[model samples]
Target: MTSTEPDARSSSTTSEGATSQPSGLPRVLSVTLTLAAVTITLLGLRQIGSFVGPVFLGLNLMLVAAPLFGWLVRIGMPRVVASISAVLAVYAFLVVFVLSLWWSISVLVNEIPAYASKFQELYLQLLDQLQAIGVSETMLTDQVASIDKQQIVGLATDLAKGIGDGVSIMAIVVTVLVFLSMDAIDIKRRIQLVRDAHPTVADALTRFGDGVRRYWVVTTVFGLIVAVIDVVALGIIGVPFALVWGVLSFVTNYVPNIGFVLGLVPPTLIALLDKGVASAIAVVVVYSVANFVVQAIIQPKYAGDAVGVTPTVSFLSLLLWAWVFGATGALLALPATLLLKAFLVDADPRGRWVNALIASRPGGGETPDPDVPEADEPDEDLVGVDGRADGENDSDDGSKPRG
Candidate 1:
């Protein structure tokens, strides 16, 4: 009876403990709830997309200029002077970009009207060719008559007007940049405060800043090379507004994956309208060769390393952010994705598994590549303030807190 009493007591205790412990929601239910929350949050963000896009753009600009700001401060420049100089530098770039875009759009609007007679001639030639191939003239006329010079002119006018309207948005972005730059004067100290309480968050922010800076540096360098190549090729081909197309190419380089296509279309179309089909073909071939060799073959390796996301993720991020914030989102997709990944994946120990899915290389950057020979000592440029490689953890246990 005594032996049985202890067994009964143990069974009772086990049952009580089991009943007292909390049970997690079912996996399906948890996922559904999370998805619902995300949907709602996205909808809210979409409502304020105008404000969000400019603010985010400012933040990205600040990140790119941060190193310059730091260098100026280190070189004995006053904090206030350095901060203003950085802000002005960014603001100057923005002004030049806006003016260039305005000039390009205005020139396009002016030039498009001059092509009306040529467009009519081409239209007749196309119709005659279609008739030769047995397509009905009446059917072709009815189907294609809507596409005329006036419609093209109207489209160009609308585009120019849209650019004019964006001046307000640019003002907001400039305002944000100024404020963010001022705050950045003490950013390191602020980060230290954040590190004291939430080390993971601090690390995530730091990584995000570093990633954005590297991305911009790589992208801008490649973009300039591609743009110059495009301009020289177009000039040799007698394409009008080659300089404008060059600027467009540089700007569109920020958009991932399809950016080359976007930059290619305007020049090709202009070549077609101005020179001929042969000239258009030449333009396409040159752009393809130049952009493919540089952007596709070479840029991706550096970009993949800089951003640490696979091609698939970068493309998907372009689509998703484009949907969320419109055209501006497309421009800011990489940085925005980096921010999300830093906080949601890198900041959480359990979420590290997601890196395997999204990371550009094996082991989510945690493992060194077997193909590359190991360095006896880490390169000084690769080392972070914590005496570890930029993305490396301090401990080998994989338990060290990271973001």
Candidate 2:
């Protein structure tokens, strides 16, 4: 009887294993369907980016302003008042941001002729140097003169106009922001309802929100410091429209890895046009130093941990998001990447492997208290004020785990 009982138990265990582990075909089909879905989603984003872009931007802005909303409420303000105040604050900031971009474009357009004239002189000087070195100026002059300055200026103007076109959609974004602020006040209650049904998804989304807010806050502080220093240095050195360039620096700081260099181009070129080669070189030096201090020295200490992404991963995300959403995608790359990580990796048990590939420090080390919540438990230990669980314990500097 004992021998038969042992045989029956072994048989049941084998049957359970067979049921739990599907044949290879089902796994292959699942992966194929996931890829297909991702492809379709990307195609849809490209097709409707104009509409989607503003909404996404507005949502990000709302998340960034969450702390302000909380602060207002803490100071004895009613929820409605706090929400309205937060929305208005965001609206004002957006207006200023858009106007700054428009002003920068206007400055560039107005000064293109000056730039062209200065560039011609520089070209002549360069030709003289090349001729002195026994290179034929006849070929160089023809090539340089053949370069249509007007066409170059026109291309820049057209690009600026394309960016300016986004102003038309500002109304939609403001409307979304207004509604989001009001709804945000009640987001916790809504999440509680979802928690009952899908705790893991709710937890993942809450973590995403927290991560995005922290990342942007740190970035904004660094951007401001860099922008102020850049403007002051450029102005002192006689670079025209220093304010405009400073604003550009602040905006471009959103793009990872190479934004500071990209921001340097316009001001340096303008310096070359308005001043001379020496001034242009000086501008480059100032930008390089200031950017190094802020982005390299100060920012890394804060941003790396707040972002929770390795340098390699962040760089790849910049390219991927730019391809998916254009320039705006590049600007929002970090936050978007965080959201994707939370949903696609942390939210699913099967995607833990993907997390291993991405969740590392920028300096290359294991992430502390890595997010690995099971659906059944949903990380109840890391509960937020909203009652949603957050498995990710990202530090302000990412060097240590948070409580």
Candidate 3:
């Protein structure tokens, strides 16, 4: 969803509008062939989705943690060793962290059925008091009963889904991280070979990898800081399942605009069940303020102008990716979209067309003028291709795009 445009036109070649080569038959045949290829690919993609999902998961893992690997290599370790070490450490930490979170949440969840009965009794008592105030207690009681049953069913479904996905997702993620991290060197080497044969496409792929890696690294750190803040704030408020909620904050914050609300809802509801409506309100307020402070204040200082995705584009990517890949897709939408944009968007003829369409300002896809030039080739500079162009990115932070 985000566009990380570079400052310079380094390895790129900017091609202006298409040459006038009118062959209506060739064009029609090309379109028909492309559609056929797409249909076949989509079917294959779905059939092997179980395997494909993990590979995508691993790619994102490598992306989110690439900086750490780069840093470790910088200090002393060989790139291979550092990459392996950093990847192992990250997965180890995530496994420990996620398990701890799941365990804590499960404990609170198990106690909820008991609390459900208590909640029903409290609601009845409150209804009787309301009846004393010239209210119709029977009507209020019936409404409360209906609401309680609905909530119970909802909670049950959510919990079951969570538990069902938790272990497999984590395992897939960890395995993918290992595979991607370990094979990254080989991938890079193979890409270099291809660059000799197809420099433009190879460069585009490289550029996209750099962008995706940087995007994930920046976002993950941003989310981690938010997660820490959530844990501290929720812990202070004595929210049950505070750790798991913190993990949710970390994950959901990546989902763009609506993700913030998704992170807030579960904990606020749990607070309502545990303490009172007042506690729930407090939880909501804390989350809103914390998110504002992290995203509006702190993150901008660090992220700078790295990602220029609009709210609409972000949400669209979320929906589209989720639809294509299912549950895992929803979780990995933004990162995957960024990756898709980076690798396939600029170099490939198809990518050029799609990017042109997406870059159109706030309107339906307008067939761009065929004469608009194509970019030459992709490189590190492609990371900042969408930015306000200067000679080069002079910031000490190397992540920024330079022309």
The lDDT of each candidate is 0.75, 0.72, 0.62
Residues 122-163, model 1: lDDT tens digits? 888888888898897888667677678898899999889766
The residue-by-residue lDDT of candidate 3 on 113-164, one tens digit each, is: 8688768976877777888887787676677777867789899998898667
lDDT of 1: 0.75
> What is the Cα root-mean-square deviation between model 1 and the actual structure?
8.2
Against the true structure, candidate 1 reaches a TM-score of 0.72
Ranking by lDDT: 1, 2, 3
Residues 220-295 of candidate 2 have per-residue lDDT tens digits of 8999999999999998998888998999888778654556766888899899888889999999998999888878
Using lDDT as the measure, which candidate wins? Answer: 1
Candidate 3, residue 368: Cα displacement in angstroms equals: 17
Best by TM-score: 2
